[model samples]
Target chain A: MSNFTIPVGPLHVALEEPMYFRIDVHGETVNNVTITAGHVHRGVEYLITKRNVFQNVVLTERICSLCSNSHPQAYSMAIEQIAGIRIPARAEYLRAIADEIKRVASHLFNVGVLAHLVGFESLFMHVMEVRERMQDVKESIFGNRMDIGANTIGGVRYDIDPERIGYLREQLAALVPEVDEIIEIYRTDSSILRRTRGIGVLSYDDAIDCGVVGPVARAAGIEYDVRVKAPYAAYDRLDVPVHVLKDGDVWSRAMIRLMEARTAIDLIHQCLDGLPDGPTVAMDERPAIPPGEAIAKCEAPRGELIYYVRMTDSPKPERVKWRVPSFLNWDALGIMLRQAKVSDIAIIVNSIDPCISCTER
Target chain B: MLDTTTIPLAVLLFPGGLFALAFGLALKGLDRRVAARLQGRVGPPLAQPFFDLVKLARKRTMVPDIAAEPVFLGTPLIGAVSMLLAAALVPIPGVYAPNPLLGDLLVLLYLLAVPAVVLMIAGSASGSPFGAIGFSREMALMLAYEGPLVLVVAAVALRVGSFSLSDIVAYQQTHGAFLFDPVMWPALLAFLAFYPANLGIVPFDIPEAETEVLEGPLLEYSGPALGLFKMMSALKAVVVLGLGVALFLPLAPDGPAGLAVHLAKLVVLMLVGVTLLRVSMGRMRIDQAFAFFLKWPLALSVLSLAIVALA
Candidate 1:
């Protein structure tokens, strides 16, 4: 009978990232939600400016673990644009392969947490187990499980031999069928539908107005994928299908991730098939930068990751700024959680895949 | 078999206290392991729940400055003890029958509801905002499920023409179990629906929903107090499942085989009805779950009552 404000997070189990929400509720219905960030802020932008171009690749990649490859890849692309360096075709395909693999793993991780938040523990575990295969692929191919460190100044640092390519092919072929089965379960399971179908609806207009990106934007029926729209890296070479849904609810967000994971699997296959036989990295040393201000954007697993670089003749850059997709996706949480039940708050927050480490960094 | 001294022994030792606690914890462990296997992973050991209780016992119980100390500290004890008594009241067909002086089906119903009431009290006493939300949710869930439960009990009592559990079991023994009777099927189905909600498992565990409320009332509890709550829940599981066995299908042979049969039935029920169901479904919001309980189970119980009255 009492209407009170419940403060969730900063240390709550539901939150994977460190953020706080002052949720005002009248009984079961959440009346208002106020979000606060900065818990995981690492001051990486200022730190990145202190480092040289080669070091900045390592620094930017440390920004967020889930989209670690995207940061370095985007930062490298911006420097490539400034330096006018053309990466070899083989390196471009290799970069795309790394990005797509991360995308599948990242999307699976988000969807798996969604299942956890909804209290379907078995589904959460199953989704995570499926994601483990992608993690293995990243480890086997890129030499690391989390921060793969694939991208350098001119191109990708990691190359696939025919055996590794065969390994990657075998992994993807096995993963696709399991991913399809999970997608089918999410699509038709009555309990999942009842919990998520209309839980946190973000209309197409709201999604566009909020400038939501990645799976969150696509879920709102907005055909705005940075891969399809901007065509960065090897995405331009391959036809990356933009997966969209009309509902804009938690269900749509989850479905979008599963669909994108499928697309990512196929994209990886295409990248491997068309992988050119050339040098993986253009230069053995860090390329010399005589750079003006340049901006580069890449579609991260979460959304659009943009890096802005400004450099003079010196090795250390004047300034380096980056905007992560979670920044855009986080604002939409206020809209999504408004008027939602207390039970739906966790799932809705998770549906946005709001990466606090990415946003605060 | 119906002595006053045996009543306390039954309540404190064999059927209730130690026995119920051990069985309940093991059942929970089995549920977790089976669920993990179903999800394709290596689960915790079957002794995991027991280990968790031991771990909880070693921690500190912190009471918030705003909390009512006695009520907050006392509820878990009360909840656990209530289940201990409730466990003895559940007759295991031929092996066990509670003393007539101790309680019967109706008294057992009131005892079964004590844990929810204790949870509500604990939530309210903690004076935390999450606790308040949990308080409201636990109250709502109790209100929603109590009607169908009472109605189901009424139908069974009316069919047997006695308020005592022993009479109901005896009637079923003489004239075959109600589980096989076409007319009592609705009541049986309603009882099936009621136990999961009563046990506070998924789809109906909206009150202590871990993600939303952070285990609600038990959030502020730690150390042995939290362990007591865990023990309370474990015993409550046995009591509720045992009640379902007693009310619907108490047809085991007399002696040690009867006790084995009863325990096996409890394990099967816990695995199939609780573990599998929890794994498959998502938690329902309070309103949705409330509406569900009031709609189908209420209707089914009412129908069973009407059918029993006519036939």
Candidate 2:
């Protein structure tokens, strides 16, 4: 019953990435927590300056697999802004399609891991099976599952033809019922609710104070989503409904992700319906780069992903930096873990959907 | 009264040692396979648990520098041995009945408690903080669940007017199994809850939740030492499930048919009670599980005991 300190990972089953937590506990209850990061840090920010503007698009996508599309998309958006390039209307809708596809996959993956951490392996497997349809669509459309390589300086790298669009529509139609079933289970299952509801609570005030974003912030009742607020790519042309909840607990976070994933499918369909006729790029030839600086932000699956690009006269950029949503969300764990049961540490950490590669990179 | 010559066969060959070990490992394999199928996965083969045991046995044991080596090394042996013996005590109705000299229901109950005790000892002696937390949680859970378990057993014993498991089984065989008897329903339900908690499945596997406490007590265990712990749990599945069958529904044909029926019932109990239940649920916190055992199972068992005594 005496106070003791336990290390919760540099390596552990619950975490997908390595980040250590030194938790001090009085018996089963956590009294304090100290987070030590930089385990998976590859110094990608520094590596970005070494690569040229066009190559860094590929480099940025490698930063985090879950938010892979967002990184390159945001970087390209920044690069396009610096070069004064307006992407073609058709390309804008194509980028949105790719973004929503990744969003559905990423959100489902996070919630699936939540089910896993909850010890509901059956539900976890079921969720993953449903998410597999999105993965298949990515593979069929972009020719790669994780890193879709769907972004370029001026616009998107890939476009959906009528056949591919039909395939996507078919997959999305099949996916809706499975996702709806999972959402219903999360809403009504006593075991999941018992473990998640009111556990690891982050208040609306605390969420704002911690500067949390995306599902974590929205779960805490903050009505903020970058797609709705900033409206990048073709999101301005599409209807993106932001899901919000009041509890700000693990269940709320998972529910927000589920709702958004379902909404992402709708957004993809909307982009397909509003498909326009034009080029998928700004121009046929590669444009010359001038010394300039610009910032671009996009709604990543986790939250708002911001890219800051500074170009010098040289082919290599002077600097490229990003602020991922996980950076702010990691700070909220101290509040969440405070006075939580030792058993809930993993569930609470998973609730924020912390992307160590994104945050540390 | 003791049949000294047949003791070794009882303990080492037919029922306890080799047979129970194989049966236990097989039960574990089936459980895993069935659970995986339930989750829509192509699971490991039925011999997977046995393969793991062989793999573990061939590996070298590594004792931590901070650990008390003797207790840490010895607890798994004790736990495995206790269950091995407990398995022998469970009568297979018309197929086999243990000798009275080999001990009875009360002795089996005490032996049944050994695995949890040694797990506690192993946890504390391992010198890992996670192990220490696991020890405390296991102890708390044991304290919570043990009351209901003992009371449920007591209710059954009072109904039959005997502490002998064979007697209880014989009584059920003639008058009708307690499984179908309305009077024994509360005790049966209490026992149903107790086995899952004792077997360390989801909603009750708090002490060694791999995510939370990193498998807690077993975090520091490695090699053949870890294999023994696995063997212990596998044997426990057989012992606990077999015990449930004997206590409530020991109605089967004589000889080989009875053995077949018993094994079939054990598999069914395992699939429905343990595997299906575990896959479908999330783990509970120790406090929540502690409260749950105290609230429902304890009350039901006490009600059964009171009713049985009066009747």
Candidate 3:
């Protein structure tokens, strides 16, 4: 029973993302977890501070591939708050629509990852095939599949017209049946249930103690979702429902993601029904950065993503400190997988939706 | 002596081991092309196997530091050799097998398992977590499919009244093929279960589950080692289908129709199977596949045996 280190990252086998975790194994059981990242680190924190607010719109999207929009939207909202500007009502609704669409695509991607991890390639392929529609919407509307540069300082830069909105509606319409099929698959696929049900159990209170946010928090029966608790953008204007499960195991987290994606789809249609006609950006030209410190929080695909800005009447911010969701969720990896079999680690790690790039940045 | 030598040489080169390899390669190519077409993409050419073999042979071998290197190195060659031997034992067109009894329907179970056991041992010796998990699951799946497959093969042997491949063919020639028999309809049902078990597709592929286990038993196999594994998989796929076809249609020893005609039938059988299996279905979960095989196909195989016994 000699202690041996099994590296699970950077270029190690099993990890799909760019982060690494070396677990100390005694025979077949993991006794300790040591994580290492920075492989995809681009020093975005420093880059964002130097760049003008307009250029950083594209810059912040690189924070996380899955939650690409939320980073920019939250950053934009922070900038607008610092200048004490009121964004156009229409702009807020559009931001909400964009965020919700991104949520659906992101959640589906994670669910597909889980399916793929469980060796259910049919469900994986189907989820991926269905996800192409979301990609289409993002490309046609935002001009890229992963990085959709939607947010401006005061509001959104582009607007979706009736024709494009109708197209978006059509894609969501087509995805509904398949989404229903996927939900049933996850529900009844007994092996998936068997492996995931009680495998990565974390009590409700333990999650809150770890400062986990979003779905991870909600799965543990904590009534704390950034979207629901502190409503921002169109979230403030409308009633947003949340899905909560008492079991904080890997499967419960997955169930929460699936339910939330459905909610996101519904939220987008609601935004479309209530979308007002007007200019996307405010009339403020040559908007200057005022002296202040502002903290912006948005429910990213993984969890609560927070960005802090400290401006001293200069265009450049004095400091840019942000907390990536993976930093928090991945810490709980040791807790979840300590005594579990070596085989369960991959799927359990996937349930956290680790954004290694964001964590490294 | 000259006449005997020429006949033996012709048999060796004509349609025995070489035919099995070519036929298996063609079926694999068809499976890939058909699967791609179903997924809406153009696939690789028919001669892709030649390129693959060349590439694999040229690549450097890296045996894992912790592995039983000799065994890991040896199993692939052994699997390939064993598969070739299995093919040689079957009655190939224009060839005389040394012993056709290995292809006897009742005793077919253990003979068919030689390649898989070699693979499992290779994976187990690799000394990686994925390999361990993969090999463990493979053993389980092996046990799962074995029961029904044995029963089905026994049913065929009962219908034919002899254990040798040549005798089974003679019976088929005398009594007509089992495809005509009502009892074999249930055996045809068993063929459905045999398909996944043979290829070890998604649901049955618990050993090499790509997403979770990171290619399972194959996690450490690269270069020439991986190549041999791939070749064995493709060849065994054809062997499995050959067993199914022989049980149902039972080849008639070419007769006046010639070697080309016999080979043409095997090729058609492989192509039809590839089309039906590759494009039409997706891999099931392991538990569901196990349940489906045991509950339905096992029952069907037993029923087929009962009907044949009565007949």
The numbered model that scores best in lDDT is 2
True contacts kept of each: 0.77, 0.82, 0.23
Which has the higher lDDT value, candidate number 2 or candidate number 3?
2
lDDT of 1 by residue, B54-136 (tens): 99898888989999999999999999999999998888888788888888898999998899999999999999888888889
Best by TM-score: 2
| DockQ values per model | 0.80, 0.85, 0.25
Q: For this target, which candidate reaches the highest DockQ against the unseen true structure?
A: 2
Distance from true location, Cα of B230 in model 3, Å: 2.5
- lDDT tens digits, residue span A1-361, model 2: 7899999899989899999999999999999899999898899989988988888989999999999999999999998998999999999999999988999999999999988898888888999999988899999999999999999989888887889989989999999888899899999998899989999999999999999999999999999998889988888988888899999999999999999999988998899899998999998888877899999999898888888989989988899889999999999999999999998999999999999999988
CA displacement after TM-score superposition, residue B56 of candidate 1 (Å): 3.1
The candidate, 1 or 3, that scores higher on lDDT is 1
Candidate 2 yields a Cα-based lDDT of: 0.91
| Counted clashes in each candidate structure | 0, 0, 1
iRMSD in angstroms, per model: 1.0, 0.8, 4.9
Model 3 lDDT tens row, A216-292: 77888877778877788888876688889998998999989998888888889889999998888886585887989
User: Candidate 1, residues A1-361: lDDT per residue as tens digits?
Assistant: 6678889888899999889999999888889999998898889878877889898889888988999999999999999999999899999998998999999999999998988888888888889999999999988988899999999999888888899989999999999999999999999988788899998999999998899988899899988888888888788889788888999999999999999999999999898878879898777787789959899999998888888889998888888888888889889998999889889999999999988888888
TM-score of each model, paired residue for residue: 0.98, 0.98, 0.85
* Residue A103 lDDT, candidate 2, scale 0-100: 92
Q: Score candidate 1 by lDDT.
A: 0.90
